[model samples]
Target chain A: MRSVFRVVENHRESDWTHTIFFDREIESTPGQFMMVWLPRLGEKPFTLSYLNAVTVKKAGAFTEKLAALEPGDEIGLRGPLGQGYPPLKRPALIGGGVGIAELRLLALASEEPSFVLGGRTADEILFYEEFRELGPVHVATEDGALGHKGLVTELLPVEADSYAVCGPERMMAACLPKLPAERTYFAVERYMKCAVGLCGQCTCSGWRVCTDGPIFPASTVAQMDDFGKRRRSKSGRWEAV
Target chain B: MIPLPRIDPPLINASGILSYPEVFTAFESAGACLGGYVTKSVGPREKPGNENPVVVYPPEGAVLNSLALPTQSAEDWERDLEEIKLKNAKLIVSVYGGDAGEFAGVTRRMSRFGDAIEVNLGCPNKEPGEQTIMESIGQNPALSAEVIERVRDETDKPVIAKLSPNSDYLAVAESCMNAGADALGCGNTLGPGLAVDIRSRAAILAGTTGGISGPALKPINLRMTYEAYARFRCPIVAYGGIETWEDAVEYILAGAGVLGIGTAFMRKSTHEAAALTRDIWEGIQEYLDGEPMSALIGAAHRAAEGGDSHA
Candidate 1:
């Protein structure tokens, strides 16, 4: 698998910086990611922020190199790997943070969508303009600093065709009540060392995040022992283990 | 990256590391790059394999697996062989069974594939399953010959009997060759071992006992490959803990045509296969090929003759 896009533009979209427009030809569904390798620096995995391609966020040094590249830049990329969200027959796009990327992509499948979004503050929220045509959108924010006080999870869709989410595990968990067991999916951002199944470093206990999955039905997360609870820290120790 | 012979692309992604190459036309790159695929060991019938949590990786990088073989079905390979699209590789099909009839049954079905068939003479986990070929043939030369003889008659393609390292390696290699196999694959994993989890005060694996492989088996695999080369007429496919291009070169020097990488692929995925194959080919082109294949015949010859540097 090779990366086909270059970081054409880079900008901060709040706390998390956004590599606004990379390559339009990336062709990933949503939630799918590309493994980027930087010469001498090593390789890391990032989720595709754009629905049809890769719109990476420039939150760190790795993204900085990608962000600094012009349209003619060449980089190593492999895969639109892992399962992405399937289109909802009806329509409900629910998400937070970069998790909104998946919901926005799902909106491409729907004639119109019910966008239920949230963020940390008013400025942190994104994709409102492009997704507004998808139908109605509801927003929530922590600290009452944005659209609604409390949490983005509070703006769960009351009724809709189906719901898709991406964000902190806690936010996805909060949306469980608003979604049917069969109609919702959450893209798990896991700590995976090797995406191609060899290293065995991404074992979520017995399940392999690389092989078993990165995307599963909402019910699947419920069945997992510690879905969103496990978080690793900088020292190679899991923070919330 | 170490300069080593890259064999083939990684194909099998089964629970352990054994590949069922005959299943798909192409293999995915997980690790190990042999020029061809060696199907996961199979039996004549369906294997329920060991109970759940059949494998356990202890702190020291040791694994204890009691995999009852839990393969789909032996005959399924026949159905899948047609779909396989192998290229420039000598597909070596590995089959495991309780007795000669069952072993031959898999080969007979695979005869049409025209791919070479390997008879798994000894798997450490066989007895408790109510059947075993190891005890019958592996422990005895006459019985081993009978089993190989039976499997040989079933397939028109080359038959390579995979011998166990636990037994007398040279004698076993000889017995299979005498029984009419075209080549020999030595050996299967080392030991019928056990692992204990101190916290639970219980055995780690479901069956409690399994085979040991990886770097631990390299020296022994080298010795056995040498012994098989010295004693047998049929060629030998050196297997066990071969992870580097240098390791593959050593096996080739000690008389292994194709080195079967099991544990390396299990740990690294099959991505190393093509890399290793290319490396070895170039090493040979740079050094080994035009000379007689027999020039690489023994450990003593390699050590004394300087076909390889003493690493």
Candidate 2:
């Protein structure tokens, strides 16, 4: 519980998502997450879309409450925790839906990153303009409301020196075989309790997701037996991913 | 004193932390200096435990937890043990039950998998009815002793009764020793403490209450360990808010045979946890100046009695 209380310096909302900018800069790399706390509402891990901000999708009760918060609201943040994406030259970044939140910082830091973003509809494809401003952007939607009408994995750049994929595990798993395992990095998500190494709740194939990684090389990700199959529920039971 | 498992550095990840077999491998691979790893306390049956917000930090800088021992079943652990391997660490299995019979059943099933059986008699965060049962078992000397006897009947391995700091610890220690417990785990977290979020008008944790641990708990746990050691002279595994080598030495000096670290791990990764362990071990070695660590156990008592309490 090493949390630093900070005021929500600014907040912007768009299409069921809230991007909150805290009062100050956080010393963290792209893949690391902060355990955002809202007093009695509890804490949940969120990857920073920027060094000083977190983009949260209205997914559950916690996020729902967080969505209702304003700029002056006080919140607590613990860590730019867990391992982040390794620095790569011209890495192709692939994200699906809200999963793009984790790769935004990497895109900001990389020299020339190729972006492949997918969503159910064009509206679901977030940060389209933001990512295009950074580098070349590829877009896909299930309903053909955007760029290409298909999955994000179909548009992954095989020519990039490396790859970083985030979002649904199903998409990442499908994208796995296409990229060289040694060169591809994947940001994983799981039900995290402590957001630290203490609780084994976020364990994926014995690796503590909170500490060992929220981001791992595809080589390591390939070795995980439960990768796209199952995940531990809040009650410690295994449920389908 | 009856023989205890060989824990070279005599430090371990406290129960309720590092439960998964794979996580154990992760820590071992990272060179965690702990002599062993304690599995999360398992019961006769699997329990999912409380909902989210299981652990929290109060404004006091201490941790409050109501994990409620979310555990896999003994059967599951047996399956895990069959496949698990650790090159440099020993395994100490912790077990809990609603009563002596339930406790014994799991111990009987898990006995062969571990070097020792840590009877969790001090967990404070349980479902409504179960909480009272656990409290009574930890606080009442007779009931506590009965649980130990039942567990001892099931396993030949050393039985370490983890006592509750909120209770009459010395009485509980004596009762447990008389009942044939080989060792004592000093205590569990302090209060089923409450930390309210004024803004939300409710408790911060989903469980409403959680046991307290951290720097704030050290003195209470140290005193309990010292008192228990002075009275029973039993091998004691001391844990309470230990974060550094100085804290480690303090417990050793106070008669702790081993140390259980929990809250500190919340802030460190495996590599850092390993470093902390090595740091604590090295600090103890420097303080010992070549003397065996055992020589320092209860040394504080000896010093207070004006005996030769040489470092």
Best by lDDT: 2
Per-residue alpha-carbon lDDT of candidate 2 for residues A98-137, written as tens digits (9 for 90 to 100): 8987888899888899888998988777788888888888
Every candidate's lDDT: 0.60, 0.84
Candidate 2 DockQ, CA atoms: 0.52
DockQ of 1: 0.04
Considering the two chains of model 2, state its CAPRI-style docking category: medium
Which 10-residue window in model 1 chain A sums to the lowest lDDT?
Answer: A230-239
TM-score of chain B of each: 0.81, 0.96
Runs in model 1 with CA error above 4 Å?
Answer: A1-241, B1-18, B22-33, B59-62, B127-132, B267-294, B297-311
TM-score of 2: 0.90
Q: How many clashes show up in model 2?
A: 0
Candidate 1 chain B least-lDDT 10 residues:
B1-10
- Judge candidate 1 at residue A87 and give its lDDT: 61
lDDT of 1 by residue, B1-311 (tens): 11112223312222234343422232333222345666556556655555433444444544455554544465565654555665655466677666777777877776676456777776776425454445566767777788888987887777777777888767776777777878777777778678654433555455667777667777787878777876663567777777666776787777776676555534322233335545655565455547654476454554754665542
Please, what's the RMSD in Å of model 2?
Answer: 3.2
